[model samples]
Target: MSVIDILVPAGDVRRMHLLVAERLAGKGHDVALVGTDAPGIARTLDNILHFERAALRIRLDSLLDAVPQPLLSLARSGAALRVDLTGSGRPVASPALAPRFAGSPSLAEAARLLMLGRLPDIAVVLDGGRPVAEASPMADSRLSVARGLDDILARVLTLLVIETHRYLDGGAMDARPAETAAPPKTPTSGQMVGTYMLSTVPRQIGGAARRLAFKLHRWNVQYRFHKGRRVADTGLMAGEPWLTLPDDGDRFYADPFPFEWNGRYFIFVEEFRHGGGKGVLSVAEVFRDGAPTVPRVILEEPYHLSYPQVFAHGGQIWMLPEGGAGGNLVLYRAESFPDRWVRHSVLVPGRQLFDSTLLEHDGRLWLFATERDGYGSASDMLVVYHAPALEGPWTPHQANPVRIDRAAARPGGRFVRVGDRLVLPVQDGTLEYGGALGLADLIELNETKVRLTEPVPILSPIRSTYPKIHTLNSSEHLETVDCIAPMLRGGLRRAG
Candidate 1:
């Protein structure tokens, strides 16, 4: 087995570095997690700087704790404070810091441990300069703790995987001399408005009121289609008018998955009641005039279900709507056309999987989903599982997380084949959950290897009045997409 040395900052024991080390070890690599006191040249940031930031976040979250959940969700949606922190970006403080080990020597010795001996084949550094990168929008801002550290851990895992691939592809490891400590540079501010304002009483009240006003609105799915096989851009359907399903104040529908069968276009969606906080599968018929018949509840579950991933196979209709909250990837068979549904099988059990999408290619079934592996945000890692048929005994890919990109990780809609390439619609959740749709071409896909080309955005909520468009689907001559916008209600109306 190849030995790997994980270098971390001395006097720091954050889970960020430990998570990386554990993942490397899990991959059958002999890993030695070592911390060094050697401060790198041209860098003077330390644990103290990170601590201050963490303290601020903790304080701010503590204040937000007083706000109700509905209003708080609205506030966070607008703030979109989770900045992308890939490299050299300042991270918020991490609350998962553990007590560090006794002081150790410099990076030179750490490098020697790798180079001078055959034991450690490579050395990696998970510095403490930036503990947590992108913050999660779901993180509570009122806690006296640094939330969203899992995002950093997830990113670390992605880097380690890439590095491992590089090494296996005949790349050599380099260990350079460690530099002396330099003066710390001035810190910059990139606080989200909600986080920054929660500390003050007056601002806190204003923020709550503003969020309350925002809560008067919610997301409703909308769609527009073209009369072709698959049109990647909406501009191609320029004159086609967009059709939106009317939503009552009590319930909203989103995540539209359209399929054509028996010369009719049918759409399955996630119909969620704002009051119950749970989602159910709903179906509607689409007319050629861009108007949809009244959507009716087709399937209801005790657990939250959304993203009705519907398809036709073997002369049978199957649905795999996201059942992440239920902690599994479930398959439902249509007992009767678009209404009567029965649980077919549990494709993947014991995991929170989101946006489970399937595509049959070359006698193999490929399933793509954003799996929350008990660590990070569900929208950042793309995990693949393959099977001989649509059901049973699915095997995970060797590189399970084939890709880790906040903007293009979650599967949005059905895959579209364009001239020997399968273009996938993915949600760019970097700014906010379900922010936009990005199109990525599947460059290489197989049981052992999976690769996707850089993503090209095909839809943006900014272009239209809608603020979110995460799901898109198309058939032979009909296309459909989903959008989310806020709904406005009145004062006595809100209370009622």
Candidate 2:
């Protein structure tokens, strides 16, 4: 077995060393987790070692925390390319760390400089100091492991570096855009307005509408993977392409989610679009067990409409789409079955809520969403909005953004309260790897507690029988990318 000395800070959970130890042990490697001793640590494998001490993150945090937001502070904290967002983000940076990593592409030197002062030739080489490489809007490369951290402090410490790179270093480590280019739509304000959607509705609406509109409802959506192209597992031998088959055509994918529809299970999801774009929403027959039968588009918007959250109150089927730039999560009531969905008022608005899920706990209705300056990066942070009645008036949690994760950052499948605690399963968006599942503990009405606390690697790219290489751009035309009009890729076909 080849043993590699993997260097990582002690307290970082995203750097999950315990699970890494288990994974490495299963693969026959002596995994060592080294970091400063902190709150929590564990071992799930036999071939693991833990080295705890005064780690690098603490040293850096201690040095930088009090310095305030300034570019010069970054130089002192062992950074080269200082991009301060502290004023708007955190601008304070330290200087005079010695610019040894002048023009490198790897973070080796910068990492080494932060930990051991000086590293070996290969050990310490500085690249562009990208805190997160996957942050790029279009660059698609990923590190997908089958299963997933370590150091409690290692997680905290890594966050320091990560936040530094993002807000401080200016996306030195950014994620590649998963899907792109739907022409900006005229954001329809469902009444309440704030720019984007958060989870609350305006007071101008009715109470019955609020209750019926905002009640916890589950809707099915199609998850189309590897829709087009064909290759050996979509270039899986090496972590090359995420889409599995490059030689094959596209696919028609659909799934059913059982939701309480007039005291019955109604299957709702994004219908399989052959020529239409990726962002379409629809509802169809709710199978005996709430499975999808034949999905028909009840509602279609200009942008990508997905993750339908449906509920019934006051004898009306209310729906909420994963509203994009349209602020204030809007309310939709079915004007008819499987065909007419009328746009009502707003539920939450003016905030960027990519995947907004709702539920009621402790006499209060809670809405979950991934908020940021944009989309695609929805999994990293979570925003919770609450209300007394579904439509009366909504309020954001005191602790609005409850969680931040690069892994399992986006709301996956659904959120359920198991037993006494709230459980949320989310997807860890690792650029193009590990669409795996993760679990977290929802403390209460507005508070969120996470288990494993970081993005855990669940699924890895395996040679699949499905067509891969699916790219959906509503605003962009296929002619622009050199594809035939009738060409079917990733389940998206040219509209007639």
lDDT of each: 0.58, 0.37
Per-residue CA lDDT of model 2 for 212-242, tens digit only, reads 4432111112221222321111222122232
My TM-score estimates for the predictions, one after another, are 0.69, 0.45
Each candidate's root-mean-square deviation in Å?
Answer: 12.2, 21.9
What value of lDDT does candidate 1 attain over all alpha carbons?
0.58
Clashing residue pairs found in predicted model 1: 61-141, 61-142, 61-143, 62-142, 62-143, 217-487, 218-487
Question: What digit string (tens of lDDT, one per residue) describes model 1 on residues 30-116?
Answer: 655454442321122223224535644433221111112211111122221111111221222221111110111121221122121
Off by over 4 Å in 2: 1-251, 254-256, 260-265, 272-275, 286-292, 325-328, 431-434, 444-496
